[model samples]
Target: MGGGGMGGGMGGGGMGGGGPPPDGLRLQYKAANTTADDIQIKPHFKIVNDTQDNVPLSDLTIRYWFTRDGGANFIYNCDFAPFNCIYTAGTFGAATGVKADMYVEISFMPDAGVLVTGDTTGEIQARLHTQNFTLVNQTSDYSFDPTKVDFEEWTKVTLYSKGVLVWGNEP
Candidate 1:
């Protein structure tokens, strides 16, 4: 027979029918500002975890691949929870000219015991580059596909708590 307790799931304040506590995970992103260097353009997006869970902050690394509309591809690896609020791209050549057809996919091996009822998503302030990006809040089944943010420049992508959407409240 199996050893100790019924092992599986986020296990916190389980649902009414003893199912599972509502998932308290909300991830968000926004850009601080944009800079055009003598060589390239540097734009960054800030990510936040707006929830009451011991959310995964950093240490867990995630690999990302970006495919632009013009079939340009970029690959990089970052932490599941980055210590830095903003994720900055290397550089966009001055003359190359860029298009927004940006599809981004991130994958990582989730670490156990990191997600709880209350945790700091990240210690960062929010910045809204209103002119550059639009915001979208949606739910996911832990699976993701590259999504487009805008048409011309890059996008500020993020993850939102499904629980908040359903309960109309955030703990």
Candidate 2:
């Protein structure tokens, strides 16, 4: 298993901080199917609503990146997700050589009130398809971890009610 870090903007002070996060909402994420031969990498995001305040989530935007760590050489192709979701490839482009990295952003919007209910959760399942996604060879100062391909740079969850902003994780 690999790990990623989260910065404040979504609620709590940081990962595993004490006290309830602001707006009683937090992002819980995980990545699976992270092997060298795995043509597809799955990254799942779950919206954990911890309070009774019924905040309606209308949209979710995730900005993330993949670091080669200088391990292997590969190409990243397309991205896939369920309905109401969109994927945008970042400007840094795909990881091609040593120390190369790729950036991607995804946006999702479930049915209104699906992600904003208190004491319940809403989830998004996404995948990234790649060609030769594994790090088989290494050159000087090159590092890549298959498990670290799903790091999230930032995320924005918009809570809305009647077209008004109830709360949000984005600035």
Q: How many residue pairs clash in each candidate?
A: 10, 5
Candidate 1, pairs of clashing residues: 27-159, 52-117, 52-118, 53-117, 53-118, 53-119, 54-116, 57-81, 58-81, 60-80
Question: TM-scores of the models, in the given order?
Answer: 0.33, 0.42
Instruction: Tell me, by lDDT, which candidate is best.
Output: 2
Q: Least accurate stretch of 10 residues (summed lDDT) in model 2? A: 1-10
lDDT of 2 at 76: 32
Per-residue C-alpha lDDT of model 1 across residues 1-171, encoded as one tens digit per residue:
111111222433322333333354434332222221111111223233334434432212111112222223333223233443233222211121122223232222232224444543342332211122322222110111224232122222332221222111111
Q: Cα lDDT for residue 126, model 1?
A: 28
lDDT of 2 by residue, 1-171 (tens): 111111213433223332333355555455544454444545555556665544333333343345444434334333433333433221223534433354334432334234434644434665554345544221211222334445332233233232223233322
**Cα-based RMSD of the predictions, in order?**
13.2, 10.9
The residue pairs in collision within model 2 are: 69-143, 70-142, 70-143, 71-143, 71-144
103: Cα error in model 2, Å: 3.5
